[model samples]
Target chain A: MTAADHAGWEVVIGLEVHAQLATTSKIFSGASTAYGAEPNTQACLVDLGYPGVLPVLNREVVQMATLFGLAVNASVARRSVFARKNYFYPDLPKGYQISQLELPIVEHGEMLISDADGNDKRIGITRAHLEEDAGKSIHEGLDDSSGIDLNRAGTPLLEIVSEPDLRSAKEAVAYLRKIHTIVRYLGISDGNMQEGSFRCDANVSVRPRGQQELGTRAEIKNLNSFRFIEKAINYEVERQIDLLQDGGTVVQETRLYDSDKDQTRSMRSKEEANDYRYFPDPDLLPVEISDEYVEAARATLPELPEAKLQRFVAEHGLKKDDAVILTASRALADYFEAVAGAVDATAQVAANWVIGDLSAVLNRDGKDIGDSNISPAALAGLVNRIHDNTISGKIAKQIFEAMWDGEGSADEIIEAKGLKQITDSSAIEAVIDKVIADYPEQVAEYRAGKDKLIGFFVGKVMQETKGQANPGQVNQILKAKL
Target chain B: MSLDKVKVQHIAMLARLKLADEEYASSVEKLSRIVDFVDQLSQADTSDVRPMAHPLDAAQRLRPDAVTETVERDRYQQNAAAVSDGLYLVPKVIE
Candidate 1:
């Protein structure tokens, strides 16, 4: 949609994200929560909703939720109830989904998202509640009937709801991204959108500038990617504005974003709107978290992304952008810390190698930092070489590539390939004398006040040494010779 | 307060139950009595008390996060009306 389309209207957006908690077992059952198993094999009697089977909540789920609550600076509920949301579908083996209604586990949370102006904007979180995921329904394969796989039916999820604080699609993306980073950093969830482990639905509406009341909202459902979230919200905003301009009122409904079409179409209208008669589940009692439990969970939290980013900036003097990229994942952050700590005097140099060359190699192979062929210590060895002038930065790149190819450590590669920088003054002077003799005209030019000719001499000596001479020593010696 | 015909119909629709026109009279009376009884229960003043979610005051017992259940798909799928490749088959539902 064009900016002119929403010129006079203010877009209001809130997100509802469903993150599957990474646990060994399902939330209420002993069924394994591992993905990609044979259909219905991991589903047990409790997950299949067999009659008279009771649900016993997992202790680790609460601990993880407490960790998340503390990470977001939120209050952990002392008592939270599990309510049953009544619905009927083949995918829902149980007639209703077990969820939280009036009392959620975490509430009044907020996170800071970098606004478009590059300022920290605090987005208010309404609540994050615990819920159970439904099963998968396959429709195409069977002739007359659909197939139901209850494997994912009882998996635990945290449904995080945000306030209507976002003003633009960019801000929505930023807010969603912050949530994704927080959940992954907390180690509570894998936050894999492609695997449907982390998914979101957007509630979007628009109003004329200066109008207090909000326009009728049409919810865009099941947006799994950041780009789609922005695109779907923008499309929905333009649609509502166009409808309003045409003297037609917007209808409140649930819409699906067709990525193929890049548009959100209504899934269900208000007439078919959901009426989930939520009541406390009688099978399970209330979950009460004690102060001691919260303290223990707090102890388990490592430095969060924001804290680590600030530490990188304040302690290591890294650029904010570089720090952000380095701390995007826990493994990457740890990798950077080790590399930087090894080369204590020059962390920016360490940052450059990790964020630049090592990242390029990892990206080229489509591998994560945890899966990089070059270990952090080996990369640190390479970085230290460049700092100590054992190998010039130019030669270090060559050694880096060799190390990525499993050619051994940086020092080993230097020895095997003979790519060490020539730092000995005697050896450098010999190359400089040869350059001065070979280019007496240029030396005479240097004497005649063409200072630019120094570059020419430096290029030659570097070429003579096959680009292995210490550049600083080359410059110092070449000036003395002329 | 009594549940009227329209309210009863909406409740039935939400429950996915289709009621005939003749069945609405008795259904409204039965459902109205249920609502009225709940309304009577609401007359007690519990404003100072905490909202009770369960009848028992005991906290929910937690099990350790360990996979203790094994796959018994063949045994469970025996009661299915139809089965295909170890999947329970029902009327085609798409949304």
Candidate 2:
């Protein structure tokens, strides 16, 4: 084994991401693969291992996996074999998890990741394989053994393995975000991190920056949020770095992230390859997918997020940063384009409102655009109101908040709240004239070369108008008046 | 295959399994066979093959940022073997 301190340390990050495929049925059995079902109620005989029960592949799951492979430009293995990943667990009724091992269904794709510096890098895709999720073990009951919720048992999961090419926590987060975007764009996984539809295990270790030897890595499991991921990896990295600095050796183990302490604690010393005791699952036959099936799934592929982002930047004249922020979520992108198309305004402006005001309100309310009371048409209407000077940007923010709270249309909110922009030159001129009259000393200071105090006069005028006045008109009118 | 017996035993120990001595011989055989199968995978002309990450082509989905509900801590801790002030108790080391 190569020692971690032999050279400069390189942080090699490979993510084992488990995505719950958005299929209506379980992968192997015909049980309803719905979330939030009562415990054990959804477990069918096939899933529960009754005698002579045969495992059948869900066509929808295979199609969804194939669609993902196509979207990422991965090789869909025409033939893939299912194998039993053997381990004893109370939650896994089937003695072993029915997962693809020797022959994964999807192989060798590249995920394009963009950094905060506007640089796009291609991360190597290792393989994506189909598997059935283990039932959740609820250790919250009076029984000595945990209560098993088999609702998640046999639920379809696609395990995406990535190459250990990432060097830092930020890169890992960017890669995760890119993966998130691709999966949502393909419409295969809902990517709900909190509900456990999408989860990640980050393999983190610190070596010298150019070291060939990998450090004894710890696997941080079941991190669902991007914030947690970045925080977890960063904390783990520092912990590892501190250990090395203190002359302590890092152990190979599986660790859990304590959200409270913001530290990683070892669950167990990590299992090696031999511990799984994997073998071909004889109960299921080798999946023989034909060219036609692959073709059909490929044909249904939508414009993936990467391609759409590129189009937005190149065709619609949006900035790369703007395209990225807009295309972070498909619904957000769709809302933006609908509004952008409706208002015929700058894409940057639409992008700004979506990422800034819209996202801020959604974040505050703990909602996405899909759950937000703001519809695309209403949002488009609001944007139009801003574009036409009917409501200033300042008033439009208020209108948006009202719209989000299920209030009336943008026009109605403006009327009811008396929020129309004070664009009338005479009215704005009068307000500016009064402000000039009231703050004559400030006006004299502005004329006496304190140019920065002009903002003070503009603030007073906007305050006098109850923030309904157009800022540009206020600035323009104030400049002429001053 | 017999030479892999020690490696199998180490792996079993790492996984916290209490295998009988008799089971070790069979586990070595089984693990050897499986390792051989995995060895064959490296030769399947995958020089051009990419390792698969996720089984699907779609981006990872996200739920609305809203907190669904809060877990009642007292109810959640009711099943613990030992609890003190809403915390699970494990055996402490040292004074």
What are the RMSDs of all candidates, in order?
Answer: 1.8, 8.6
TM-score of chain B of each: 0.88, 0.76
Docking category of candidate 2: incorrect
How close is candidate 1 at the interface, in terms of C-alpha RMSD after superposing the true interface residues?
Answer: 0.9
DockQ of each candidate, alpha-carbon based: 0.85, 0.05
Output per-candidate TM-scores for chain A, rounded to 2 decimals: 0.96, 0.87
Query: In angstroms, how far off is A133's CA in candidate 1?
Result: 0.3
Best by DockQ: 1
Give lDDT tens digits, candidate 2, residues A1-482: 13454345567788999999887767776567667765555666666655788777777777788998998889999878788887756567667888988789999998877665767788899999999998765554333434555667888899999988887899999989888888888888999998999999999988867667888888999999999999999888888887897899998888899999998898855346346777777666666778997998888998888788899998778888788788888888888888777775686777777778888988998887888687767887898888888888778888898988878999889889889888899998988888888988888889999999988988998899999888988888788777
| TM-scores for every candidate against the unseen true structure | 0.96, 0.77
Runs in model 1 lying further than 4 Å from the true structure: A268-270, A436-449
> Model 2 chain B — which ten-residue stretch has the worst lDDT?
B60-69
> Model 2, stretches more than 4 Å misplaced?
A1-7, A115-118, A239-250, A269-273, A421-482, B1-95
Give the range where candidate 2 chain A is weakest over 10 consecutive residues by summed lDDT. Answer: A139-148
